[model samples]
Target chain A: MTPAPGDPAPAPGLIPRDSLLPNLEFPFRDLNSRVTPTECFYVRNHFPTPALTAGGWSLTVGGAVLHPLRLGLEELRSLPSRTVTATMECAGNGRTFLSPRPRGVPWELGAVGTARWTGVPLSAVLERAGLPEVVAAWEVVLEGADRGVMTEPVPSPGEISYARSVPLAKALDDVLLAHEMNGEALTPDHGFPVRAVVPGWYGMASVKWLTAVRVVPGPFLGYFQTVDYAYWEEKDGLPPQLRPIGPLQLKAAIARPAPREVVPCGVTYEVTGAAWSGEADVARVEVSVDGGCTWADAEFLDPPMPHVWRRWRFRWQTPEGPGSRTLLARATDTRGRTQPTCHDPARGSYMITHPLPIEVDVRESSP
Target chain B: MTPAPGDPAPAPGLIPRDSLLPNLEFPFRDLNSRVTPTECFYVRNHFPTPALTAGGWSLTVGGAVLHPLRLGLEELRSLPSRTVTATMECAGNGRTFLSPRPRGVPWELGAVGTARWTGVPLSAVLERAGLPEVVAAWEVVLEGADRGVMTEPVPSPGEISYARSVPLAKALDDVLLAHEMNGEALTPDHGFPVRAVVPGWYGMASVKWLTAVRVVPGPFLGYFQTVDYAYWEEKDGLPPQLRPIGPLQLKAAIARPAPREVVPCGVTYEVTGAAWSGEADVARVEVSVDGGCTWADAEFLDPPMPHVWRRWRFRWQTPEGPGSRTLLARATDTRGRTQPTCHDPARGSYMITHPLPIEVDVRESSP
Candidate 1:
């Protein structure tokens, strides 16, 4: 498996050796799968997987600070923490759908997951790290423990700690020093024992196996978040930047017909799937049996959970009319966002919802 | 852990000896956090962990007609599978929220999780198993390869295979013979190789390390699903029929701030956690700082996958006021079904949405 055309380019030498772009599997196609199993879960490396130890991990906060300090994991953990329900999306999510195909891993739609992140707020940690002088744009430079003396140049530089900054305001959004995911300790690949879990943002912001976060006077520019994953593009021949492709956009899918679906009609069927958004609660999901002309709301099971996908269902009794028919499902979130038609399923790798189609056979209905 | 009133009672002699309940760093507050880490994941056992050689593992699904089957792992993998997002609630999710603490493990709260399930559809497997005569009610019993034999007399008499069945309907409702979770292979404990994943239901419906599924006639009256986890609760003060709590109810919680909360004023703090339901999608989660008077819709992070819990947040600028403020969160589904303010968290030890309380300081805002 190689990088899907739409996927983000590999961070400076981040692609592993002998690693053919692994063909990713779409999560939630089966009802008994791990929502985001370790392996298949998307990997968005800033530089490369840094080798580090928990016993020696320490984060430093500097700049215009009253007192700059390096707090050990033990010390960091000793501070108060805020748990958050956040969904981390890779900036390159759904990238494999890019037109002409982007040069990246062909992610088969399995690059996202929602988790209960537990960690000290970035503000508290930064405050504890001491906010150096009052600058226009505060840049928090994160440095990892991995052996990286100077892989790139300065100003527009690259370091080990995979550092990036928030808009001061967004940076203070109670980010967590996430020590856990779901309810288990962070697995090694996902930044064992620790990672930054920022809510409502892209995965790049949530650095893994993090260490030092130094405050600078200007915007932090690194190769990972800025150069590779982030992009500007236009829709339908419009001007660029109208729909910036930096972070996660709203999306949904039919989990029932996942991977592949086949059925004999005239039988009762419950069409179901999931829907989500960056800032929207899924309001409804519509399914169409005859293309996109007619739509119906699927019965949603249980109340919606924040940071989790909303499951919806629609019961259909196929008529014993004729041959095969395509069933299409589209979801809409509370922000009045509906799944877009598959304008071009292969065009944009991420964001736009690709109409999920299920092919079924028509049979005689039971009396 | 002993089976309390609300907890699902495993078979007699099923409780483990070294079953000292492990202490969690955080208190039981949210529906998702109730999930135990690998070490703490609740194990509802009917028999002890089995002993078998992978060398001899074989599954046979053939009876009356056409394509009778006996397939090994390799043979099964040759077939395609569908994936789905579903929540597996312990039939006794709210058992721990019972009155005077029920007679079980005294589970702190309803423990549940949502994951992406992958496997061949049960309908396909049944298609291979060949459709036997359709009975009135129907029973599609599934059993594991583990050791254990029920001594109870067969109530139905015509027991075709050691299996249970639902209305030939449920079997067609996207049941899966899942081999993967999220995107990785299933863990041995959860159910390796293969298992049945029934969406919109409790954990028991999913038979692990599945051995066989015989479509018998009539309803399933297995000890674990029916006699043990199911209950008769006084709904509106009436003890209805001793029916199994089929679907889940609205539930929400604050991951932290349990027992009590003590914090300095003006320090921007975050109140977050998970919420879920078995019956409908949670529409809105309202948090109250002044007990139950003032309600504010907290920020919720919707999951990219469906039927999972959404992580939610409510950021408040600590007021210049001072007093003991209790923090409580509740949920409502698309059907306008909001979690009740009921103090008792358990509904028949199965579904509980009891309001959780927390005390916080309202010191002046940080300078």
Candidate 2:
């Protein structure tokens, strides 16, 4: 039963961000485990789960290829497989924190998760299908099975499938036509039959329930590509510029002893969290217990692993003062990339990897 | 050029721990990068490098299999491949820190590194070869091409190859017959043609230049498995009990502002370092700048990637007075496993992931 207005509806263990479309987040504290359990993996869908089965599912590779081919599950699995552990974050992961909050899913810091994905490389499939002649003016279009209708910014409304396009070089780099996740078959909520795993890009580029792969010459102005994912902004009294969102920016968040938690004063508690980036490896992570006054570097639990998020932890000794305290964390990558302290208001609803602060109230120690 | 008695022979970038047999360590500070570059990766060779080529390499999967099979490089590459990022440490990684150093390589902390390995899962190969009937007594033996003469505990000296055996369950678990490392083909020093990547285990379990996979019944007493890698000791008038070394223990080390470093007082500096474990994910890492009087949790650069090492850093505010100081770090894993403050003298030199203390001298500020 729905409670009050603006209250998220219950969906098992999910922290629902919106009542509609089932956009939800796994409680960040449950991230203690290495790989996010399939049941706890975050779910973000544009439409209802598609009705499909592995028996009837097939991926079509066409357009600009010397030999077009359609591969079933068995055929795709026959190719040499590769596995990678990677983290994926929704483009609007921290949308709720924006000033004058954005008009989308009000996500907190739980919209990201990491997993081990196994599949055949897109390049291997392209090479097996006989690659087209090398050309600079080529783009790869990916279309998922989920389709719906949109009303906003439309003159003539029509049905459209969830689709996006990437440059030829990126599609051929490390993208995977994935079939398994975390050593098991994909679940229905996470694109049951097949999906695209684009290594360093935002979640939108990884279309789920994938069905078609098109190697098109020149750009294709699809709805998701041209209208939705691009950020339009008017700067300095000039004409508006539209820039499409791409890689995920560096960011960190405190997960344990979640936001606004209360604890006993003088007790030592552990402050644990996660940090991630799109393409670059994290070079360093610094944490601050007294807001941002004094920062201390936290110890990473694991060695640096490419393309995957890293877990970090800090121990905080609460002073005897019975008052509110704040904790903050920030990340930097090897490519000299860092999270911005403040975001540009013009760039809304995407790539928000800001260093979020968590508040905790310290009470007098119990007798 | 041989410089001195203990100087390791020049082998490009390897930091020699021993002069004769190429026992080396990757410079610990060089671990700032995510994946250790091949040139700087630590090397541990028991004998001269073997002369083997991929063209002549054929892995024989025989013994207890229902249908034994021999696979060439092309055939192995044709199978489904999987990739994982994992940390591997020599059993004697911190041997130098042990009091009364054992009669082996006096290695420092540089004997550990993490990398992305790509290969076929050992389970898949076993299934393809037709797994034998279920039996609790089954074991898997892996033999490498490198061989040398043995001189200890023998009536007659004989030649023996590098070999080890593991329980069937572990052999079938996430083990990979790795052929590539860090997105490229493996190098000569790092087992060029192929090797075993036994995730979460010590480096000895991952034999380099792997040549044979035998499914043997009961236990196989290979030299590396029974004699060298096991820890044998007597306790309280009891018979000498032997336990085989398996997973890596939780541990951490300060990488920067190294031991005996001199820094100006009254200046705030950042302390950087790394921590890792065998099978378990690290739960927390605490740093003590003032000898263990007070402990502060260090910040991790990233979330814990399963089976990989983690980088960490901390900010230190040097006291005004100039004197001697000590820095120490200890790690704990999710399984409630923590590094011991002091080791039992009887344990000797293997599996020492203990909390290491670093000495530093704070100097007065320059006039």
Candidate 3:
């Protein structure tokens, strides 16, 4: 669907921009959004879109399995389960926000989305596979039911298993085998049926459309798991350091109905967006109508939860008289982690978690 | 094909050690290389691969034109063209080599590749389209036959097309709308039939599976062109710089076998590799046999051409005695640019070009 007039399409339609193209297109915006809408969710697809059907689907447990068995959706549902609301942001969400110019995907703002996931603990599936009763690192491979699966392992060291391993600890967290989202069955677009919910890790580790689970020793070095998300750093003659899966970093985004929306003369408005972190719960989310010179506490929609997003909203009365106005949103996660004031927009590695400043086209009120 | 047992796989195979998975998969080399075979080339699909039949495919030129024209493969073949054996590095090629950890598409070393891209001069196509008569500053957009086409009025102020644009001047260079590769019809994997060969620019500017050309005003920010390959630095302490067509920075790769090759004792060997630069030609490529202590000028293949790779070969006289040896290759491009020593694995903004120190496994030959 085409967006009317000069409006950027919300999630489900927003495609991160690529920098290398010859011409510039689109009127892009970086919404320091409070709540990332579904349609506006940023997407990062590795291969061709796999057309999966739920009717004949089953989650299979393989690899070091004593009894490799395929459990139908019904069977998976029969297993003990739980539910949790969490947010998942692509590591490259705010990539374009980086400086020194990070490589790979050129994300303008950040691509983040929150949803309620329902699934069984990854440990449950692995247990059914039977323990190897051995000592060593076995990577938990998650294979998607797609044609690309054939050539998948060919690309990575492990035969293309759509898998990522969690240490024996994280996999057993009463983490749900999410099948329902926000009280609705998982939509095909959002990995229907089941997907892993390994809280505190980057979204990539929470494999969408989770299928099989295995207990691999050592590290989960699936191409996407180990190879892709890893980062190697060499600053000033120091040895390079590689960052594997760790808790999410603190970040905030401001999103609203208005793109410089002109509020009626003297009309009041609300400043809102989302704040989250894999590190810790958010303590407070703040908004600055005066470009961060002053901060106002934005009410959190709900008490913060671990690895879950905290929605913050602040209501403000537009100045009785106005020419134009601009506002910003910033949040402070629980661990004394405040939302960044400005996205670094680094070019070399793609991490640009900048606070957003937006222009508001305010109209003067007539008496 | 699987590599021989004793021989290491091009990339992520086990490193014949007690450990199964190596600490790091893609080892850093001064020259960027994909460890996998051609089949394992990291597929950076900006858009779905365009499916064009070689039987009878034509390119359509429209949008701001005297008359919409369709040129068949034959017509494009009939046009005068040129070909160059250049290396196309994704502007984001070295993301795996970054620090402070940026975000976005997690691309490995494979994002860079060397191919004999063939194409007709885009300027010739514009002539056939009758430019000057059509539009000015009027950018041209290239749309692929693939369903994924950028929305109209490219997101950029330039209003370029879904494909990147070539300034009117550069488009007219001896650019090729190549029909053959290494003297063979284009392979589908290599954009068979037709594609642009934008010299000195990042791979994104050279749209694959060329189909539609729409000339308009402004930069063409298509999904492939703009949304995915850009870098922005809007941070507090930063200087403004003109964005160029993302060009491949100076890069070099070891062409000779890695240092790990087992060499019979007391045997002299040759150290070799290739170097390239996008902005300028390579001036000098040096080889350091003694681990960067002493340097020697490696022989550079002659008539160094822009957009073409220059091969450098250095003959090394192995010590007559017996012991494991270390071999190294360092290349400098034409612009007096020298390869940086491997100080840190994650080097620059996606351009991790550095001097390589190859390790050789030596076995003494007994009398």
Candidate 4:
């Protein structure tokens, strides 16, 4: 049987998914608190999470380092910690909107969220381990404790530790080795013992339950890096550029005045939502009550915080006409990147940053 | 930071728990179908579930068999399969109600549910494997693929596989090696590759992610079998009787008219609930609205089915005077086993089969 368009009935706190596998997304409309609750944070596990006890688990840093280091939970905690409020978004955040609908988790707009991550910076750990100065091209590979095999991009399948690598510059940047999320120890779904938190990159780069960090001389060849998360740039007669997805694209989504919700025709209603970008700060957000035909700037509820999303709201007086109205939102980051009116099918499911149009029905006030 | 007592906000379809270590319970009040939905079927994982791929996974049946068999998923599926609708209740179902508060998952009344399981019966598998008919003290030891060192029951600190066993007679009697639950392939939370479904026994006896089945001479002594699930009958100054806990107890619980829920005085309310027993069928159920001072026979909505629960209801007419009231329910099985009013303190967390008292307030109705 074909899976329903989306998860028919998702667990609470999550938006439904196309795949029944545990690709859970947080319902961002319920984002009421400053820090997203651990239970409400989006969970994107490639495999079932392995349980690790504090006493028996340790993080090992080796390969291309002057000093190979193995640090237990307490030992890692003893290092100076820094906290950063970062917003993480999946590369396939709006995959359901992709035409020909990709054969993976078809997520909607709820796959993006923000949380206060507390941990030692990867740079700090690398400094203690003593990184060797090298002129050759190098990539820092990260291996999560979760081990499983993938059946996708088939024909050349093999078992792999859930592993990925980043360029040496990103690895030495503000990337964090996070052990705590939202002021609490990470839950099993979020990687309990420790996880890598790449501040501005898409979530898959933030490997959870991180156990190993190895510096390899050359570009990484992991399936997640070379195939799955890569985008195809199909063009006219030229070879498709298989570009691995990195930073998130500018995006905005309506969280309030939900789809198909009934509203009083003559009453003024407040439409609220969130806007975010990967590396750049959100400069402005626009709301369109006429399905992108016309747009109006939304008032920001909070000032822009560097790696975090900002909430924006717009008040609209309902039209006298009693019918359905389409609401749309688009965001522009400081880099002048704005959402597209529609998605590019050739790009497949990665970075689907098209503006979402929500429909709300207007009804006569009972009073 | 200390974890809160019960999830401040539980996911849809799951009942709250004292410990947040994924001790999910079914919301029995919403029990609406013939078989419990997989999402609502109550998850009880002592350790994190490990992901297993179908390609590299096999169930090995060795020891005391003329032919030691290692069957892959397809090979296992090729055999004759049977479907059984069985009710599974955790051994520590009502642990929260224990006087001295047990040291594990503090579950309340929601830790029991029924699901339709499909798989090959252990009897048929044993028969096909050519079990030797010999007169010896033999036990069938089952081990799950999940490996984790446990710290419990004191003193014995060593690495042991998650394993348990049963007497040869019980092992070969209608035991099912299930690969599916509720007509669908088991979810990872419920054991993905395969699991054992032992009817008439507690949920722990139905080990999940089963990997090995060894028929060994003499009783099998594993940590889960000899220590964790065992009861301690501590008598004053005397050695304790370390008896293994098994089978479901005669239990009844009020599903509707939840504790602390307000109801209009003088209104007729329908009180609904479910009751079940292992081995013996439920014979009768009694409900009391005045704290057990008086009792009334609850009307059975469905007739008692073997190994499945029966739904029951009662018409409760609220008194004209507005005040708080307590509701209670009890059950008796065909074996003449009745639920105790209180638990055995020395038993320590397993099988607390006492009638639950729910408190509710009465208020005036709105016109």
Q: For this target, which candidate reaches the highest DockQ against the unseen true structure?
A: 3
Residue A251, model 3: Cα distance from true site in angstroms: 2.0
Model 3 segments beyond 4 Å from truth? A1-43, A63-68, A99-110, A132-139, A146-163, A233-238, A257-260, A263-267, A317-326, A340-351, A365-367, B1-367
Give each model's whole-structure lDDT: 0.56, 0.75, 0.56, 0.76
lDDT preference between candidates 1 and 4, better one: 4
- Candidate 4 has an lDDT of 0.76
lDDT of 2 by residue, A1-367 (tens): 1121112233357787767677889888666765787777788988778988889999888878898899999899899999988888888887777777756778888898888899988888888778767666577878888877744322112456777777788888889988999999888878878889987778888889999887876554454643456554433221233445777778887777677777678867777778888778888889888888998888887677877788887777777789988888998889887788876544556777667777878888666
Q: Residue A220's C-alpha lDDT in candidate 4?
A: 57
For residues B261-309, write the lDDT of model 2, one tens digit per residue. Answer: 6777887767777888877888788889899899999888868888887
lDDT of 4 by residue, B145-216 (tens): 776655554312333456677777888877898989988899987888899988888898888889888787
| Recovered native contacts, candidate 2 | 0.00
Name model 4 segments beyond 4 Å from true.
A1-12, A15-21, A134-136, A233-238, B1-367
Query: What's the distance in Å from true for residue B157, model 2?
Result: 4.4
Residue A364 displacement (Å), model 1: 10
Interface RMSD of each: 29.8, 34.7, 19.0, 26.5
Model 3 per-residue lDDT tens digits across residues A1-367: 1122223444334553543221111122434333345455555555434456677777767666577778888888888877776777767665543555544565544456766667776778767877667543345555554323222211222224344556665665544567876667766556666777667666667766766665544444334432345443323221122234455777666655244665655655655566778877878877777767887888876667778777666776677666676677776765676755554311123334556566676666444
- After TM-score superposition, the amount by which residue A109's alpha carbon in candidate 4 deviates from its true location, in angstroms, is 1.6
